[model samples]
Target: MDKHHKINIEYAKKLGLKSALVYQYVKDMNSDTKLHTIIEEFPYLSNEDVGNSIKSLVEQGLIEFNDDNQIITLSSTIQKTKIRTPISNRSNKIDKSWSPSEDAVEVLQRAGVDAEFIDGLLDEFIIYWSERSSTLVSYNSKFIEYCRLKWAQHTAEIDTKSVPRIIDKNWAPSEDCLDIIKMTGIDDAFVRLHLPEFILYWKEDGRAFVSWDIKFLDFIKNKWNYNVEVTSKEHTYKFDLFDPYADDEDKSKKSTKGNIKDLRKKYKI
Candidate 1:
């Protein structure tokens, strides 16, 4: 038996289910085999799985297949080493199942991401990193952190309604939302403070808020600085036009006015 042809359970675990089986079969054979022969030998693997396994084996340097020949052969490097007994560790049988840490879940959830989205991210992340020759991520913490930041950044980008364009005509900002203003270079604290209003301005103007962080900088660069006081005065005029004493035909309309007025004062429109 050639050592190059032999594989340990750990190596097989990394190769995963279909790839592991393909590797074991390749190791057992004395000569090169066609892709169809391996598929015929193992009836369970789907055509797609067989193809993926072959690609994985080729990437890992365990096997070689030339499109010209369409035959699978154990690499000469593997053929030169002495082989050992086949894998017997049932626990090492590989699959793609993985559980994300609770902290990682919480981090994403705080940013409005859910389980299904995280699962997809994890699948792509695992597949990408596992195939690379040298992984930069040496710890689970780094991986979790990567998921958390990327998830928030991307999630914010997709959520069309997350950053609303207008909360009533009179827009206001809270202390926390003020964080957005600090990052942008616009000097006016009022503009920084009424950042949400600016978001609403863009929204009402039919612009998509693609990047929550960048949109502010862009707004300031284009609009906010042009006629800052006029924007402020117009919002105030709209606020005054609202009749607080108007007939509340549908009692629900009272709350609407109150909400508008509250937002007006809160944002200092």
Candidate 2:
């Protein structure tokens, strides 16, 4: 088997370094490859880095995944002629009226980008490149790259705006979180009982989370379930040990001692 891998410089220039490396590896395989195989091949790159590069390759129509998402194959759209040609030999300055090719637009759309969004970016993209002295072999390739970056930034900005901030001292569960707990038949008082401890522990630990409400929900549910189980066991034990002649005060003392032991066990204190 051949160990040498050939990379298309045109694709490399358009996709950037990591994506170019991944593209060549996939192309060389000539068969479906798994995500882990790519990751393993590049020991220096982090898992997230490999994943993002694969995403870029897909967006640019260089590669695609199978139905199970475990196998990757080169896209039929990739042309051997284009890959073999040296881009620099044919490089030319961007024309003032340059627009993306229909194929380039189709590739972006196939990646789930909105058509109107692509249209909106046209004038700005043309103006920015036209003013630059740099030359490119394929303006269509450059356009696809530009659109992918802008779309990523636009969506990231929207996501950042929607969430706004991290966990704070004034953090509290959202109404939706409370409603979910209510649906589980856990009483509101039980939720309130653990609220202070939850807030104090999180605030003191000082870790940022995207949604504190979700953390609170999980914490409350676990604590509630544990309490229900303990209470049921205590009730059964009391029934088994019931004595008609036992003093009421003695029974109360025993119950208090048992609760203290349970509390100590819970806190590991």
Candidate 3:
């Protein structure tokens, strides 16, 4: 099977899980299908979701719609047919000011990233790798993953304004809760099983109301200092795009797939 077709099928399934109408619209969309046609057909959808769904499909290379053409069409990837388009003259250019493509920007936006900081975040990622070595790896996928990290960092910095409402002002960890948790053993599963207890204890006594799941896990790891026997999964190294291909660079740095692996593991990407 074609790689692009496989990718579209996977992404379509993901979109389907969100909204069946959106999924069907994506699966059936072609150059002749107008945006208004979709809107009229799926009246239950908000214009924003419909628009977002379209953009997401485009970003994933399932579809394409240029502003000048105003025609929605299956992307070459989705169609499994090539349509010749003007190739960029600067495709081989080497410049310090290079930025991610529009597809990359759409991806960041879909991930709920703030637009203003995207360039800065990309620059930061590039500079981080540049300083370590001249070689770069996994330009598109890694950069997409980088955008996710930046979004996470950005959200974490800006604390949520919603006040933490106590579920029960007088709530205390019951003896049963403690006993069950203890019996569950000191592991991540134990913490997950008694998350309510952890939340109440943290809010009431620890004075920490963690909102992120990762942060909550870290808190449990630190507070309990318990070892969980988590089996480490094998990491598959893939490099689809690398700019200024580092053919002559030292193999050690140029082929340091571990750098990206370490990053993925650290951020749980």
Candidate 4:
């Protein structure tokens, strides 16, 4: 009926209403529950305004409650719905019961999240902004190191006792897997120990090979002027021991971001 009431009505629409609750409460000429309930839940309205609006709805016969019996009866069953009318023109055209969107329809069936929470996220303006905002693919130096270690462990899962013939085909390692190998810094013999006999023989069982094309090792070499060759390729064809990122150098050079901005934003979201 007025500006304040208009805002509350819109706000309340997001919160699902139980038809039985509204009808029973409205039936009572003097509701015992503090009028503060409407204001508190909405938080967008003052106590006086929310109380008076509920009173107005009662006066206008929009809601009807019998306080003594705790019975709620709506003047029109349609009047008690959370949605004022319909979400779209097509909805008005359908005489048959409407099915929610593929997503919206799930709420009536599932219990994972409250329907109101999902609805708010799907509001037109919110959806529009979300579509525009870019999502991040997170990466960390230590986490990358962990992945390489895990990859070594993962490959070890293959059995050494498989049908023993050198296969004609070899699968090129994934880029991430290769990066792990580069970062791992394990001795070639250690690398061989982790590999299945099949992988070793599929190439050449007699030789374990390591070659250094890694740029990071060179960066460490020049900056600290540690001429110590950390790069090693332990091969049956050739073998050498080197410390690419040796223990002697300062560990502080490893990049740890001054700020973890992405993690902070994700926490806020």
* TM agreement with the true structure for every prediction: 0.26, 0.32, 0.33, 0.17
Better of 1 and 2 by TM-score: 2
| Candidate 3 global lDDT | 0.49
- Please, what is the whole-model Cα lDDT of each candidate in the order they appear? 0.55, 0.67, 0.49, 0.34
Q: Which candidate's lDDT is highest?
A: 2
- Write model 1 residue lDDT over 36-93, tens digit each, in one string: 4565455444545676677777767788775433456788633323422122223322
Give model 1's TM-score versus the native structure.
0.26
- Displacement of residue 242 (Cα, Å) in model 4 is 25
Candidate 2, residues 1-269, lDDT tens digits: the string is: 11334678987788887888888898888987765456546645554566668766666777875423345679874343332211224445777777676666787888656899999998998888878877543455457656765665565456556463545667666555664565455677888889989988887887765556657867997998899798878867776666765788888999999999999999998
lDDT of 3 by residue, 122-228 (tens): 67776765555333211443465556644554454455443443434444333323322232234335465556765666566745432343344445545554332
> Could you report the Cα RMSD, in angstroms, for every candidate shown?
23.4, 20.4, 20.8, 27.8
Model 2 worst lDDT window (10 residues): 79-88
Candidate 1 weakest ten by summed lDDT: 85-94
Report the error of model 1 at residue 181, Å: 69
Off by over 4 Å in 4: 1-140, 155-171, 182-269
How many backbone clashes does every candidate have? 11, 0, 0, 12
Best model per TM-score? 3
Off by over 4 Å in 2: 1-91, 160-163, 167-269
